[model samples]
Target: MSAERTGVQTRITDVAALAGVSIGTASKALNGTGQLRDSTRQRVKDAAEKLGFVGDARARALSSGRTYTVGMITTDSFGRFTIPVLLGAEDALSAGQMAVLLCDTRDDHVREAHYLRSLAARGVDGVIVTGRSADARLPIDVSMPVVYAFTPSTDEADVSITLDDAAGSALVARHVRSLGRQRIAVVTGPERHRSAVRRADGASSVLGSHLVAPPLFGEWSERWGRQAVDVLARQAPDVDAIVCGSDQIARGVCDRLRESGRSVPGDVAVTGFDDWDVMALASRPPLTTVDLRLEELGRVAGQALLALIDGGMAASASVAPTLVIRESTVGA
Candidate 1:
């Protein structure tokens, strides 16, 4: 055996040399392809292991003509809602033997465009764009199959899967109404968000002639919830119930209501969207919230990506949101 030299970099050649075989034989043996003696394969594997040799993913993709990476782009606000969606998408991707490349656009077209270009350059097999809502224009030049989860692309060309907020919000409204509260108030994210608007619309359709607190336009933040309720308390003094766009927002609303000397469901009932488990565990009285089925959103998107990769036909998909009742709003 030749002695190792100082400052000499190692390569496949070095593995082949140490294994006493050709570079092609070393590659075949390590990759477990082509016919080779079992002992010979073991020798190549041990040599490569000792050398800490690993193949380049990009190189492998180029050679096979299938980049195993899929692009996932989302908005900054999506963090609260997209956790399960991403989890489901990753699960589906892993099961299908693919990798995910995540990017946050923060609801900016310029940033979204940059990521789209980068993902295309990387030759990703497909792209999944999770929107904060279904009211933004996607740059239409992306070459790979694109799937929109929870947020549909402005162009109808892209496949979309979203929570049926219309149904979910209406259900929440009915629950609030059945409690015999005629005066209702709502604090939601932004009117520009199609999901938020849809939720408001659904709630309105159910709670006719009820005073809806002026729709608060803000990001999905606890502080927004606090501020929204503070304003609502003064504007709609007779308000009997408060509905929040998300659970985090509900926490703020509940806290603000308490600070204002109002007892939850005793003075003013509070309800929220997004059945955030962590919030439910930490809140004083477990929050009554709606489950948007985020993981299912991810699962559907993942399945869609696989279908696209496998040359399957195009089809639209959607999932319904469900309400989870708790102490904050009713049955206290």
Candidate 2:
């Protein structure tokens, strides 16, 4: 009602009225919350933009007593996969005009509980929980909003955004198949590893008709890769493609195949997972891999948590893997 509450030329009501939505809807749209349809959200945003309306984050937080800070917990701490996810979450939160507080639990439940309590006491508006892999972990039984990044919660209802390992593996399988290779086989991590099983399931679903041998389960090391290569040669001597569950395994396969008087892509086409550049590029002819899009995963998690904090519906999402082609599969 007062001019002070309304800006000199524009007001929240003006935005809402122009967008054909309620004031509450306008507030949620500007605040980056309230699960409006993309079209609706865009309309609201366009209305605000045309009116030159700017909503101050600090002012909204002060008026609503909202902290505008999101808390993130990671089990793997700064492990290779976790950092990129964390970075993505940070970028997304910052863009939403929020801050993030990170707690590294190192896979300890006690420490995780302590951090959850501490974050709640600090009044974090929401929480993002991530892990090194996509395996489902137990939920953080906090009262506030929570989003799992790159890790699903055992509670099926909880919002989780994860990399589609099955999709990634199938992508590699199809790529190798497209290269005119019929006898495809797999070498991957331990059988107990969920990532390994999921990846195997994915590849097998697509390559069932073309598989020469079953996936060889082993550790996530070059030594295992080397050993598996030898084993597969005997089991399926005519195997023309080896689809590794990881870059490490693929690198090892590449090494052993060459040592055994086989040429990569000439005799066998090798591919791996996780598009981790260090290993992919350093290999003899570089590696063809599936990029899990870890950064994008984290970014989506961050945005989802923020939206839930703003009283929106839970956002559960899955990202498809991107196939990165290189000398190993394409042939230089």
Candidate 3:
């Protein structure tokens, strides 16, 4: 049935009829909710635009009882890694006209609970939960939609975004192998950390027979890296290459190697991860490392969370590690 336009007023039912969809489906498309096909949504939008349909965008949003704000809750807001994710997320969210409310809970469950309740009371459209690592954790129950970034919720139903650490480590392994360096060893963080374990697993699978020995699971500090050097020396004095789990550990390994009169990428090659500029760029010969694309991770995570808030479907995604070559791996 053709929409009966009484004067210049075009009702929502008119747009619905023009789009050949039910009024509810048209409302979902207009309200930016429901899992409507992209084509269907576009059709509704086109019909609305064609008919010069007029409605208060903000009023329609408010009708759904939404505040048009997203809450980003992080355990470590100032952490080297967390900052990039936040920066990226904020950039994307700002572009989409979504205001972000940041809260640093620092892993304190009580503080976290308070933030959640406060954000819910503020009527935030959704929440993006970011943590220091990608390890799976218990699900958080809340009234609003949530997207996990950096840290993933173990619940299969929850959407998450994280770095592909194993794949990245494999890239590092391949780069070392390409340099004709065998006898590779890894010095990483605590064994219980899922990120460390995944990185080791990836490097080992690719290194195969080239691996000199198993990885040394220690702390994520230069001190541990330096201590690990002695252990590696005892285990394999002729170690030709070392793959550190982080730039800090790599720095310790490189410093110790220099003291031992080992030329980086000459007598012993080294590599690190996270592509931290301060550490990687200042090394005697810059450190080769993996760029986790954390900023991109945040942008993508923000986009995903926006989708969830819009009542659209978003799946768990991962960002790949990019190898950044420097003097540590390839001689200057």
Candidate 4:
């Protein structure tokens, strides 16, 4: 009655027949290739499931001339940012029945080179390069298609997906301004960091003369955020809002503000970038911040890389940020 019981392998033709589509269409649907409607793809998949059909990896490789695998190289050893990106990529790649090989370079050039050679040797179809920072880096020397996530490729021609840092920072500035916070101060990470510079510039562009003082550049840590409050007291004692470059910094600012008998939102509204749950949600009044949507960025990068692997053109793109409001900016 069934292919398993009859000792016959269930073929794509059987699936096509059951789904009322041509063999080519079925192949395309199963292989995640060609343009097909969602309903059509679902029909074919359902038919395959009913027939207990399993595509053979060896046959697929032979027919497609691909190893059905991709490599992800990340320099973020702690996986703070890279993990979400990797998870999003996996979600996209798994839909096409592709596997991912992770390579952690730990910011070592020698180790990175080794991993590159190793991925090449293993015949990975493509590589996705990512890092904790959003700064651009030199493209990896590879013949196959490559996509950069978070850390963009320096080459304009390469396919890179990165967060829109300036736009995100602008959102924060506008949010604070909308709250009638006239005296605003920005506190962020190192001045040399591209993200910090972009965020500061974006907020400056929006707040303009309302920006009470120049952005305070320091470490991307709670300590810096706490210390910044003291400086703000002396520099802009009447500051009504503090825009932080990171959720960690915002949490620190909230804590310090509370200790100083200042009510969050009532006395000093605060905003942060990177809606990191651990910091954003844990803050005294919760933080109103810009969500970078790193996972979505990774999904886009994966889709772009897949297109490139499928003989599509390469292009660089940016993902817009989302504004997440909380009690920090608006009273609960």
What 10-residue stretch in candidate 2 is worst by lDDT? 1-10
lDDT of 4 at 123: 84
TM-score of predicted structure 1: 0.72
lDDT of each: 0.81, 0.89, 0.89, 0.91
Q: Highest TM-score among the candidates is held by which one?
A: 4
| Overall local distance difference test of candidate 1 | 0.81
Q: Write the per-residue lDDT of candidate 4 for residues 47-121, one digit (tens) a residue.
A: 989888877877888787898999999999837889889988888887777799989999999999999999999
Best by lDDT: 4
Candidate 2 lDDT, tens digit per residue, 15-83? 999999999999888878868888888999999887778777568778778878888899997899999
My TM-score estimates for the predictions, one after another, are: 0.72, 0.82, 0.82, 0.87
Task: Quote the positional error of residue 171 for candidate 1 in Å.
Answer: 2.0
Candidate 1 least-lDDT 10 residues: 1-10
The weakest ten consecutive residues by lDDT in model 3 span: 1-10
Better of 1 and 2 by lDDT: 2
Candidate 1 per-residue lDDT, tens place, 255-300, comes to: 8888889898898888888888887646656788898888988888
